[model samples]
Target: MLLAVVLASVVFSAHAQSVPKPKEFYFDEDKTTARPIVVVEGEGEAQVQALVRERDRGRRQLEATAQLAHIAFSDGRTDLGGQLYQQALAQTDAKGTLGRAVRWNYAWDLFRAGQVEPALTRWVEVASAYGSPSWAPPTLALALWRLDRKQEAVAWFGAAVRTEPAVWIDARNFASQLPDWKQEDRDTLAEVLGAWQANPPTWP
Candidate 1:
């Protein structure tokens, strides 16, 4: 009788252990993908770990992928983030606004990861697709500068100041940090900044 009771208890414990726990999910307000809710944990690292599991399960695949990519980037896993971003891009519409935002984010991630060539390609695509996203000017300028395209970098800085005057200060600050930028490029940026300051836009 004692042996049977012990055996029964062991079996019950094993059965319980075999059953997966129900995961609690919540909506991720920042993402645009369908079924954006994911499993949550207490906070910070624990939450991120839960997200990693959710990402692997293919639940809300695109949103989970993008979220994981962001978390990876924040955690200093830029290579993983870039790879995940590429996967997310494959799931997103190339012509849509979400696609543009994802591409821009991926480009920035690549740049931060020291993958300049790939970053340059993505930045060029962003610049060509939409005139100038707020981040495009400085980011594209940096990419161009890294590629030894000084003239193009100057042109983009001028475009930033002329088209998106609100980001002129950002562009100026970034341009000032480029070690390879020529005097001509600096002068061009200065000229555009002067023009923008002299004739500030009335509307935001």
Candidate 2:
């Protein structure tokens, strides 16, 4: 009888492990893809460990795959992260908030690794997924600028400037405007803004 109780307790503990509920965990308040890359240090070790266990067992369901993919990136396992991100995206609605969040984080991971062109593609997909979300133009502008696509960059900048010209024109506002971006990203966007001011895009 005592043995049966111990076995049942073990089974209960196994079944009681918390299932991950992944919403748009990587998006900004603006519902745009965020820039901050995931790091193992950002989450609880317990949660990370659980996600890894799920990943190894191939038991990662749709949203759980997203969480494990994020953890994989945080663990510096880039290839594994990419694979898992692909798997999650395949299983989820690619146009949904959760899907965008996964793609955004994947793009960020690529961008951080200096794969800017691929990152740009993913960002463009996300930017166009909605009615050109307010948060995208600035980041897109800077990325295009970085790639020497000056005209396109300026056009993207124009969208942002139109929305918040007062904010975009001043360098002081950039740090606050892009609170989620790294200092380097903010600086590059400032450069793009400066060039756009020198010769604004032509339009109606």
Candidate 3:
């Protein structure tokens, strides 16, 4: 019964996109996820510089720049963010895991800025790549939701959850950004969660 409820309730919204995992910095040894990074708001450029100066190389560095781009977009500096995202893509040829992650971030940024067409175009490129990370499908679902393709969004969510049951935690965390993700969404998502909570997918 709980399983059915979790599936039926699979609540998530497209707006609650994930933050790219920070590649250039680490939490202080004593800190847990409870502690937040507290750089002053609007100093995103400085943060980017700090991350760049940390000597990231190859895919690592590209991901760092992508993280910087994410910070910039979150700070309302879309032009600067776009430039960094482009630079990251250039650095990696946009074909590997980190590269795909960067593309995902770039697509989400573009979608948030209401540049839906370009965002969707970029999303296609990310989806086609080999070894795209776990983040890709949910990010795609979020984009589809924002574009008002609710049914497609739901299907993508199902795929994401099916492929990565651990991703339900992500879905729970990102619940705010999915389609129909109101209180009602929470109720529905509980169904999906209930179903998968005990039987997360494993490699065949």
State which candidate has the highest TM-score: 2
lDDT of 3 at 65: 72
The digit string of per-residue lDDT tens for model 3 on 47-111 reads: 66666664264335655676777787878899999998888788765566566656766776787
Return the lDDT, model 3, position 107. Answer: 75
Tens-place lDDT per residue, model 2, 99-181, is: 77777877777677676777777877776565546777777777777777777777778777777678788888988878867
Per-candidate TM-scores read 0.55, 0.72, 0.50
What lDDT, from 0 to 1, does candidate 2 have?
0.68
How well is each residue in 104-178 modelled by candidate 1, as lDDT tens digits? 666666666667667777656654555324445545555666555555555555555555445465545645444
| C-alpha RMSD (angstroms) for model 1 | 22.2
lDDT of each: 0.57, 0.68, 0.56
Give the better candidate number (1 or 2) by TM-score. Answer: 2
* Stretch of 10 with least lDDT, candidate 1: 17-26
Q: What is the lDDT of residue 167 in candidate 3?
A: 42
